[model samples]
Target chain A: MARWEPNARERLVRAAIDLFAEQGYDATTVTGIAERAGLTKTTFFRHFPDKREVLFAGQELHSRTLAEAVAAAPAQATPLEAVAAALDALAATFTEDRRDFAARLLAVIAANDELRERAAFKHDQLAAAIAGALRERGTPGPAAGLAAELGVRAFDDAFARWSDPSVARTLTDLAREALDELRAALAALG
Target chain B: MARWEPNARERLVRAAIDLFAEQGYDATTVTGIAERAGLTKTTFFRHFPDKREVLFAGQELHSRTLAEAVAAAPAQATPLEAVAAALDALAATFTEDRRDFAARLLAVIAANDELRERAAFKHDQLAAAIAGALRERGTPGPAAGLAAELGVRAFDDAFARWSDPSVARTLTDLAREALDELRAALAALG
Candidate 1:
């Protein structure tokens, strides 16, 4: 049980994710998550602004890590390449055991209209962050923007492939393969 | 006023879009749309299930068209290609004249979380419709799903490009171009 000693925050996430998976997102409540976590509702609030916020911990972290990776990239690297590398770095945080939870979270988001909108917003934010980082590194207007969006799409392709139950490769390996596939696909257009 | 004749449906849509674009989605009332359309408020309820339904008149039609297109495609066609052609058929309806209303409607949806959720739900429905169509056309399981998702991503890319005031082409043209781009990128990966 040492590995399972969840803090209040982790407990809330686990409870929320589990209850959400078992029943449904709409049926899950802050009260339920808190009670499952052995904490009061106030504790849940302290850790997250709303029930929705608790469900998005991994997403927020991914965004931060992705942004940092893009920002730290070398000068003169193309925006798409930089963003692709950043995405790979983010994927390294995932492990084989985490794939099930991640996949469930993704499916849950995909299954719900409200969560899908949040996911889209986060995708936009991730692209914007990458574009901003690119501009700072000297990439220009729509080029940076388009590259960022494309990078995001490639990362998405990588994520979907990686999260599949039958796919046994590491997330980074899948990301590289996805990036290569993306490059080939885009180049074919030209 | 021939162009603005009392097509009650059109009038309602125009009024609703106007109110939504101007006052923000949540704050605007169905009564406001009715009043603006010069009809009784009760008539608004007659035309729309709720205020929210006013913004999305032809989403179902669009999905059906896409499904039919996908179903009718050649069995040998690649999954992504088939879905792109289907979506292209759907894109044909958005002429340059509709750009303003479309952009405004998008902006309104973007500003409101609830409206955004509804939009995502609608998009997912379209994706499912396309996936089912692919299955009917003899495309395999997860490949069909991935193709449907890729098609959605292509449509999204084309949408962002066409919706930009700086973009100089129709959605179909942009979509075709993006599809080519996708093909090239994927080929490069291979």
Candidate 2:
């Protein structure tokens, strides 16, 4: 069904980012975004429920990928190991191709308090999804929740590192390094 | 100044919570809350900037408590220990007298996605405050951020436990237990 719409989703997302960057998020509207994309408002609605959704459409994909990766980890892997695996898989999706878009999107979000709140909620949602996956893999209670949160923090640090223009490292490499730093930090706490 | 205002803030908060719980957050208005509290709209505005503020008036106090506790920790304490001290001090403020209010507030926030987003924002604010305090004490990035986040998670879990009707533990005790569990969990990550 989505194939029939060609690149409507991508076009809408790009149009949103461009308009948001040009005029600020508060000044942008769904209708204006659709027009910028050379698409109808109806077509825009089919892809996203709201203007904000355009900036966050990839969340479901990211969450699904994370959960699936955790679930597919080796049976003997510890909770933290499974979480690290899940984060590595998710980091791979943030390939170099998306770096420019991510940087711009983060700038727009950083400028708006509402968007920052939405980002926090999105992070919590991913943590919860990852925790659910860990629980399914037999990790219990606070362990699963703690490991899930640590994974998200590592992803955040790695993504920020990867987004830096001066950093030539891949997102996967950055993520692994970030996880190692966090694990060492945790061990130091002991 | 606040003493002259008597319990006007408390009255307004109680009225807002009762009205919100009865008629829902969206349906409850400032005017209705003021009327219920035997106060004028002007008085209500003087106490709270908005309806939502009535439910979250303690945030500033909580943030201050956390930052102060972190700052007051022994200079020799590790980043994680400083964070634990902050959580402990903040938790001590949540005496059994506030349990019912905390439970109701959590219920209201949970029922409304907008409120929940605001709650997440509040959590982020506290985390930032803790991180700032930790940095002030010479802790560096990633270490301060991660420790602050772990502290917030411990407070959250402990608060939930303390709010449980079947649980008779003091918030301070619950917090200690929660932080201990988190520390063990983090160590097990190794």
Candidate 3:
């Protein structure tokens, strides 16, 4: 249904970002975004609740993609391995297409307290979602919770590394290294 | 300089929490908290910049205490264990006198987004402090960062479990358990 909406929800998001970037978030109005996308306020309202929703446009997709990635991991993969794969899947899903927007959105969210809190909440939700998926795969108790959270935390660290142009490693490489670091630190306890 | 404030910060915090629980946070004012503590408004303002200061009152001290705990860890201990010991130290500090008020503060911070964000930021600061302490103890590079963060994260997870009334485990036990879970997950991939 959304596919044939011409300038659909995603298109509105792209137009919104462009407008927001060009004129700053607060200065850019929904009407201007819709107009730029050749979309209407009704269509925009049909797609999103408000302007801030544009910043979170990729979150649901990111969460779903991560869930699917965890679900698809090899049966023999360790919990962290499964998590790493899930993060990799998310990186793949974003591709080059969403990289700019993802980074921008992250920066905007980082700078805004309310948005940062929302990001933290959503990250917890994703961690819970992954933990549940791991439970279905025979993972247990706090181990599952730790694995899920470690994955998200590692993702955060690795993504921070990967997103920086000065960062020398690929996203998957960074993910692998990040998990390796998690391993080494955990092992140091023994 | 802050020491000559009369009733002291701790007294003020206790009084504030009591009044907040009795009359609610929004309904309670600094004057009321100070008056309840039998201190003047000047004394209250001397100890705290404002009313919200009491709620987040322990952040600096908490970080310092944890840092000291990590630094005091024995050389034979693994990074994770040492970090765990630091957390144990902090727990012991809590159990000594003010655990109930601490628990109430945690609950209050957990319920409010602004407070939670501040809490999260403080955690980040604590983790960074731990990382610096690790480096001082001769841990290096990303290893130090990872170890410090792992310790902090593990401590956080363990504390959450330990503080739960339904969870019967001690913080050390939970920390060990979390490390075991982390070790198993990481070893599977290693």
Candidate 4:
């Protein structure tokens, strides 16, 4: 059934985000989202457990992407270097076509406390994934955790910029620059 | 009326933790918790908004403690130093008497998904409060955020250790040691 529906998952995500932005997240119902998507409530449930999850659909995939990238980094690579590789890999997934949607999604999340909390949970989960991967490569516990944090922070900072209309640089470039800036900021902490 | 029910808040918290631990978080109810506390449901409502909030009663106070300590640091203090001071101040509130309750609270949270998510949200909120204070003290954005994260992480790590019966060190000592270890780990990231 899903195969016959074409891009059912993508369509549901777009429709949900559109409705959330239009009517506000709190007021938008899953049934209305399904109706707007030209799909059924059953289909919506099939793709997402609930409306809140539609906005964070990429969490599991993004976590896997990061972990795999870290695991694939050269054995001799430093913790931060491995983290940098993971960030580049993850950033490549956010193509120009998704920029507007990403921007709107950020706004919708910012306006809702539940969504913001879910976003923070997703952020920590991604960091955990990256940290776990680094640890598997024999990076020490605290270093792995700190490096993973930097990677996620870099991506998050870059993502905000990438979502903006005026930011012309690629997500990859922005993430790299953000990571470099954070590394330098370490000195300023002292 | 409130003045007559001395330590009602503390009694409610203790009862809630004991109930949550014995019956499991999901199996517990506000009415049951209130009954265990020798308080009315109305009194329970006066203390907490919901059953889940009972386990996280200190969130607001903890955030204010971290922020105030950061704000009160000397003008010459560095970002990390300010964050360290905040951690020490926050850790001081968790006296030896609360160790058993703290340990039980952690176990209950770890066993429940909703509780874990709320814990993570509280962690980020604490970091944000500390970061805001650091920025007020003229710290740079990235550095402030990073320092605050380290402070929170240190406190979290130290808290787990402090909760252990075998760990004789004070929360302040454990938190300070954890922060120093993280600072050292920063060098290992590269």
* Candidate 3 Cα misplacement greater than 4 A, ranges: A1-57, A109-121, A165-174, A184-190, B1-5, B15-53, B74-77, B157-190
What are the runs in model 1 whose C-alpha is more than 4 Å off?
Answer: A1-6, A140-146, A161-167, B1-8, B31-49, B63-100, B116-190
lDDT of 1 by residue, B131-155 (tens): 8988787766545654675576577
TM-score of 2: 0.94
Best candidate per TM-score, number?
Answer: 4
- Writing each residue's lDDT as its tens digit, candidate 3 over B33-140 gives 889988889989877987776887777887888789878999876666667777677666555244355467767767666566566666666778877877788876
The clash count for each model shown is 23, 0, 0, 0
lDDT of 1 by residue, A91-137 (tens): 88887887887788887887786687677666666777877877788
In model 3 chain B, which range of ten residues has the least summed lDDT?
B93-102
Superposed model 2: Cα runs more than 4 Å off: A1-4, B1-5
**What docking class should model 3 receive?**
acceptable
- What would the C-alpha RMSD of candidate 1 be, to one decimal place? 5.8
Ordering by DockQ: 2, 4, 3, 1
TM-score value, chain A, candidate 3: 0.84
> lDDT (0-100) at residue A85 of candidate 1?
79
Q: For residues A1-190, what per-residue lDDT tens digits would candidate 4 score against the true structure?
A: 7666788899999999999989999899999999999999999999899899999999999999999999999999988899999999999998899999989999999998778878888999999999999999998899899989999999999999999989889999999999999888875654
Q: What is the Å distance of residue A170 in model 4 from its true position?
A: 1.4
Task: Report the Cα RMSD per candidate.
Answer: 5.8, 2.0, 4.8, 1.5
Model 3 misses residue B168 by how many Å?
Answer: 8.8
Superior by DockQ: candidate 1 or candidate 2: 2
- How high is the lDDT of residue A21 in model 1? 85
Residue B86 accuracy (lDDT) in model 3? 72
